[model samples]
Target: MQTVGEVGERAMIALFTAAAAERSDNADDVVIGSGDDAAVLAAGGPVVVSTDTAVAGRHFRFDWSAPEQIGARAVVQSAADIAAMGGALTGLVVSIGCPPATPVDRVLALNEGMVRQTHRLGGRVLGGDLVSAPVVVLTVTSLGSLADLAPVTLSGARAGDVLAVSGPLGGAAAGLAVLSAIEHGADPGLAHRFSALVDRYRLPQPDLTQGPIAARAGAHAMTDVSDGLVEEITTMAGASGLAVDVDSAAVPRPDGLDALAAELGVDPVRWALSGGEDHELLATFAPGDVPPGWTVIGAVGDAGGGPTVDAQPVGDLHGWQSFSET
Candidate 1:
């Protein structure tokens, strides 16, 4: 079997280019796609760009997730960032670092995963780089088109705005807990009951369409739940000079999360509030302008120093930070 070193960088690029081409619609903006040294993109108005990284043993494990899942997860998170900015995805540039001894097939599968996920949002992989490393490291930079829409920033939130989320929260964290339990001798049968959570951890499906929807609905500020809910809300509050008050009872949890939490002797609400990587959109809007799909969870107040949950100040408002102790 050929390893990455044997197949070489050019060959690897060829594989990725072919995979991207197969899945891409060849949009006119992507005039120069993956085969080139750099991709050329044309935008009618403002373009939003964001980048995110995933690493082996940190972001994921090959034993727990397939290469495709890893690729999709990386792409989804980056796309979610663009979505958070109230933009529609246009293209992606993915760079990968892996051991030279890694199998070429694994690399191809990773590229396929990125291609597949981008294709789902009507986007394509424009270009990227490959390098040898001690472990797998993937970085994705996503580009989006605003289409003349004003970009929403965390600073746009104001006092009296309502807080809401576009989709379910805490599912990814719950999924991680289940995976941990299985690793430590928990019953595998439980997997049948929590399959959605497990799948979510492996491959998060962010509501990419919601970003533009929220923008159209006049969202004042927006962010994705890449970190825990409290952490993100706090960041937004701090940025906007407002105090966000979350109603814990109103935070939406997945359908079976309560049952799974009961089985694990964990608090479902805590997971919903503190779990990261859900990639759900959290936005602040005028009370009467809350979008149809969003679930209202809280309200913004004049800056009283920080954020609160149920009228009390929040403690331990931390989330996924790279290099922080797990």
Candidate 2:
């Protein structure tokens, strides 16, 4: 906690550097992990490194989410970050912090889940750390290579760019709602849809294949919708200094989203806008450059900065903050 509070990402990294200097194997390749906006890894090709964390109760609950599901979820979200960078997943380093009283079987199950998801997402765990904490906090860093390919960024989008999303939204949101409802003793129909939502929460399909496809198609800018659709679109808009107008109707919502929302007495649009965890790709394409896997959703506009849906402003326009108490 002191490392995170008194020190930022840089200073905290320096502490780790001092600790790792004692190790003999990684003496040379640990370049620039202490100072940059991103870390430097000595991959044969362009470096691709991304980090993600999953916590108990917020990101996962043991009673509702199984051990294997929680493990796989961690790997999926981390790999999604690399894919969002238009990089292929080559390796993952996992760190797990759990209470000492936690069962050994549960730990093994979690590792199995991580292995299964890593293989499914085209990656493997190169190394990891284990520590004791009050709750399970799993952090994963994924490394990959661009292989002489250009790195796609979230800031390349331009005005008049056509916006596209690769897959349907609202699946994970719907599933989470179902699980919540069941816990609260809601009706069966509303609760039965938990399977689909749980799938989104557990096994996020990051379209590992489409990042390169979008790049090949001349995508102006691209990102994964780990946050809700509205929030991520707005992020791209901010990064590119433009406004993104998403046609809400153009978003391909998955099966049972509306009815599930109705049962919860909530607006489906809210889930489509604010509810995150659906890790689909949202990108902007140059005119006549829409890729095969991408679906056109909206257009890049000039005014009213940040992200909007059908010309209406989206809430907050940011992804889930791990530290914000508000």
Best by TM-score: 1
lDDT of 1: 0.90
Per-residue lDDT for 1-326 in model 2, tens only?
A: 13233334344334333333333244244454422344444577677889998999878899877898898888878887777777788767777777766765666567668767776766555556667788888998888767666878999888889999888877787787777777888766654445676677556665777877777677778888877787788678888889988887877777777776776788876677666788887788877998776778899988547788888777564446567562
lDDT of 2: 0.72
Q: Please, what are the lDDT tens digits per residue for candidate 1 over residues 162-247? A: 99999888899999999899989999877778999988788989788999999999999999999899999889988988889889
Model 2 compared with the native: what TM-score? 0.83
Model 2 off-target regions past 4 Å?
Answer: 1-42, 315-319, 324-326
Q: How far is candidate 2 from the true structure (C-alpha RMSD, Å)?
A: 7.6
Worst 10-residue lDDT window, candidate 2:
1-10
| TM-score (all chains, Cα) for each model | 0.98, 0.83
Query: Any runs in candidate 1 off by more than 4 Å, and if so which?
Result: none
